[model samples]
Target: MKFILGLGKILTIAFWGVVLFNQLLPQPVPFNLLINAVGVTVLGLHILEVLFFNASLRGRSHRWFDRLQILLTGIFHVMSIPRQPQLPRNG
Candidate 1:
Protein backbone atom coordinates (compact mmCIF):
# COMPACT_ATOMS: atom_id res chain seq x y z
CA MET A 1 0.00 0.00 0.00
CA LYS A 2 2.77 2.41 0.88
CA PHE A 3 4.55 1.62 -2.36
CA ILE A 4 1.39 2.26 -4.32
CA LEU A 5 0.82 5.56 -2.52
CA GLY A 6 4.37 6.66 -3.19
CA LEU A 7 3.98 5.82 -6.87
CA GLY A 8 0.77 7.82 -6.93
CA LYS A 9 2.56 10.84 -5.43
CA ILE A 10 5.30 10.65 -8.02
CA LEU A 11 2.83 10.47 -10.86
CA THR A 12 0.77 13.34 -9.46
CA ILE A 13 3.80 15.63 -9.19
CA ALA A 14 4.89 14.79 -12.70
CA PHE A 15 1.41 15.50 -14.01
CA TRP A 16 1.30 18.90 -12.30
CA GLY A 17 4.74 19.78 -13.62
CA VAL A 18 3.59 19.02 -17.16
CA VAL A 19 0.46 21.09 -16.73
CA LEU A 20 2.44 24.03 -15.39
CA PHE A 21 4.95 23.81 -18.23
CA ASN A 22 2.18 23.72 -20.76
CA GLN A 23 0.59 26.80 -19.19
CA LEU A 24 3.90 28.67 -19.50
CA LEU A 25 4.10 28.11 -23.25
CA PRO A 26 3.53 31.20 -25.45
CA GLN A 27 0.71 29.51 -27.38
CA PRO A 28 -2.01 27.52 -25.69
CA VAL A 29 -1.75 23.78 -26.22
CA PRO A 30 -4.58 21.75 -27.68
CA PHE A 31 -5.22 19.93 -24.39
CA ASN A 32 -4.64 22.95 -22.14
CA LEU A 33 -8.13 23.05 -20.67
CA LEU A 34 -8.27 19.33 -19.99
CA ILE A 35 -4.87 19.27 -18.30
CA ASN A 36 -5.61 22.34 -16.21
CA ALA A 37 -8.95 20.90 -15.13
CA VAL A 38 -7.31 17.66 -14.03
CA GLY A 39 -4.66 19.65 -12.16
CA VAL A 40 -7.35 21.57 -10.27
CA THR A 41 -9.14 18.34 -9.41
CA VAL A 42 -5.94 16.81 -8.04
CA LEU A 43 -5.27 19.95 -6.00
CA GLY A 44 -8.76 19.79 -4.51
CA LEU A 45 -8.29 16.15 -3.52
CA HIS A 46 -5.01 16.94 -1.76
CA ILE A 47 -6.59 19.82 0.12
CA LEU A 48 -9.35 17.48 1.26
CA GLU A 49 -6.78 14.95 2.46
CA VAL A 50 -4.96 17.64 4.45
CA LEU A 51 -8.18 18.73 6.08
CA PHE A 52 -9.49 15.28 7.04
CA PHE A 53 -6.58 12.82 7.31
CA ASN A 54 -3.75 14.95 8.68
CA ALA A 55 -3.03 13.19 11.97
CA SER A 56 0.72 13.15 11.29
CA LEU A 57 0.92 16.96 11.43
CA ARG A 58 -1.37 17.59 14.41
CA GLY A 59 1.29 18.65 16.94
CA ARG A 60 4.19 19.82 14.80
CA SER A 61 6.00 23.16 15.18
CA HIS A 62 6.71 23.59 11.46
CA ARG A 63 3.25 22.76 10.22
CA TRP A 64 3.39 25.02 7.19
CA PHE A 65 6.18 23.03 5.58
CA ASP A 66 4.49 19.77 6.45
CA ARG A 67 1.34 20.96 4.76
CA LEU A 68 3.33 21.93 1.70
CA GLN A 69 4.82 18.46 1.63
CA ILE A 70 1.35 17.04 1.79
CA LEU A 71 0.41 19.18 -1.19
CA LEU A 72 3.41 18.09 -3.21
CA THR A 73 3.68 14.43 -2.19
CA GLY A 74 0.14 13.46 -1.29
CA ILE A 75 -0.81 11.11 1.57
CA PHE A 76 2.36 9.07 1.19
CA HIS A 77 4.37 11.92 2.72
CA VAL A 78 1.92 12.13 5.61
CA MET A 79 2.23 8.39 6.22
CA SER A 80 6.04 8.59 6.20
CA ILE A 81 6.19 11.30 8.86
CA PRO A 82 6.91 9.82 12.30
CA ARG A 83 4.54 10.80 15.05
CA GLN A 84 5.80 11.15 18.62
CA PRO A 85 4.49 8.30 20.72
CA GLN A 86 2.53 9.34 23.78
CA LEU A 87 3.51 7.93 27.18
CA PRO A 88 0.90 6.89 29.68
CA ARG A 89 0.67 9.06 32.82
CA ASN A 90 1.31 7.50 36.22
CA GLY A 91 -0.84 8.80 39.04
Candidate 2:
Protein backbone atom coordinates (compact mmCIF):
# COMPACT_ATOMS: atom_id res chain seq x y z
CA MET A 1 0.00 0.00 0.00
CA LYS A 2 2.76 2.40 0.90
CA PHE A 3 4.58 1.47 -2.26
CA ILE A 4 1.51 2.14 -4.35
CA LEU A 5 1.00 5.51 -2.76
CA GLY A 6 4.66 6.36 -3.27
CA LEU A 7 4.43 5.38 -6.93
CA GLY A 8 1.35 7.53 -7.40
CA LYS A 9 3.10 10.52 -5.88
CA ILE A 10 6.13 10.01 -8.07
CA LEU A 11 3.97 9.80 -11.18
CA THR A 12 2.11 12.95 -10.23
CA ILE A 13 5.35 14.82 -9.68
CA ALA A 14 6.80 13.57 -12.95
CA PHE A 15 3.72 14.78 -14.84
CA TRP A 16 4.11 18.27 -13.45
CA GLY A 17 7.83 18.20 -14.01
CA VAL A 18 7.36 17.50 -17.69
CA VAL A 19 4.82 20.28 -17.97
CA LEU A 20 7.20 22.67 -16.30
CA PHE A 21 10.16 21.65 -18.39
CA ASN A 22 8.16 21.86 -21.60
CA GLN A 23 7.23 25.38 -20.72
CA LEU A 24 10.78 26.38 -19.82
CA LEU A 25 12.82 24.80 -22.57
CA PRO A 26 12.71 25.66 -26.22
CA GLN A 27 11.64 22.80 -28.44
CA PRO A 28 10.54 21.89 -31.94
CA VAL A 29 6.85 21.66 -32.83
CA PRO A 30 6.97 17.88 -32.84
CA PHE A 31 8.54 17.81 -29.38
CA ASN A 32 5.90 20.20 -28.09
CA LEU A 33 3.20 17.91 -29.42
CA LEU A 34 4.88 14.95 -27.77
CA ILE A 35 4.91 16.70 -24.44
CA ASN A 36 1.25 17.62 -24.77
CA ALA A 37 0.43 13.99 -25.56
CA VAL A 38 2.34 12.92 -22.45
CA GLY A 39 0.41 15.38 -20.34
CA VAL A 40 -2.86 13.85 -21.50
CA THR A 41 -1.52 10.36 -20.82
CA VAL A 42 -0.51 11.34 -17.28
CA LEU A 43 -3.99 12.63 -16.53
CA GLY A 44 -5.39 9.30 -17.62
CA LEU A 45 -2.87 7.51 -15.43
CA HIS A 46 -3.91 9.61 -12.44
CA ILE A 47 -7.52 8.56 -12.92
CA LEU A 48 -6.42 4.95 -13.15
CA GLU A 49 -4.43 5.35 -9.97
CA VAL A 50 -7.49 6.69 -8.16
CA LEU A 51 -9.61 3.77 -9.32
CA PHE A 52 -6.96 1.23 -8.35
CA PHE A 53 -6.67 2.76 -4.92
CA ASN A 54 -10.41 2.65 -4.46
CA ALA A 55 -10.47 -1.08 -5.20
CA SER A 56 -7.36 -1.92 -3.17
CA LEU A 57 -8.57 -0.04 -0.14
CA ARG A 58 -11.09 -2.77 0.67
CA GLY A 59 -8.56 -5.27 2.05
CA ARG A 60 -5.56 -3.12 2.83
CA SER A 61 -4.32 -0.44 5.15
CA HIS A 62 -6.80 2.35 4.61
CA ARG A 63 -6.89 6.03 5.45
CA TRP A 64 -9.99 8.13 5.03
CA PHE A 65 -8.02 11.24 4.19
CA ASP A 66 -6.14 9.54 1.41
CA ARG A 67 -9.30 8.10 -0.03
CA LEU A 68 -11.01 11.45 0.14
CA GLN A 69 -8.12 13.10 -1.64
CA ILE A 70 -8.19 10.49 -4.38
CA LEU A 71 -11.93 10.87 -4.83
CA LEU A 72 -11.73 14.64 -5.03
CA THR A 73 -8.90 14.52 -7.49
CA GLY A 74 -10.80 12.09 -9.62
CA ILE A 75 -13.81 14.37 -9.62
CA PHE A 76 -11.68 17.32 -10.59
CA HIS A 77 -10.12 15.31 -13.35
CA VAL A 78 -13.46 14.39 -14.84
CA MET A 79 -14.73 17.94 -14.64
CA SER A 80 -11.66 19.51 -16.21
CA ILE A 81 -12.03 18.19 -19.73
CA PRO A 82 -13.18 20.56 -22.44
CA ARG A 83 -14.72 19.81 -25.81
CA GLN A 84 -12.41 19.83 -28.76
CA PRO A 85 -11.98 23.06 -30.61
CA GLN A 86 -13.02 23.47 -34.20
CA LEU A 87 -10.21 23.42 -36.68
CA PRO A 88 -9.85 25.69 -39.68
CA ARG A 89 -9.60 24.15 -43.13
CA ASN A 90 -7.65 25.41 -46.09
CA GLY A 91 -9.67 26.85 -48.94
| Among all candidates shown, the one with the greatest lDDT | 1
lDDT per residue, candidate 1, 1-91, as tens digits?
Answer: 6788778778868877887886787236547877888778888988987887567677888888889878877777777777689889999
List the pairs of residues colliding in candidate 1.
none
Show pairs that collide, candidate 2: none
Model 1, position 36, has a per-residue lDDT of: 80
The positional error of residue 58 in candidate 1, measured at the CA in angstroms, is 2.2
Question: Tens digit of lDDT per residue, candidate 2, span 1-91?
Answer: 5556556656656666777788898468998888878777766766676777564445434446555555434434323333345589999
Model 1 ranges off by over 4 Å = 1-8, 26-30, 83-91
- Among the numbered candidates, top TM-score falls to 1
Candidate 2 global CA lDDT score: 0.59
Stretches of candidate 2 exceeding 4 Å from the true structure = 1-12, 23-26, 58-91
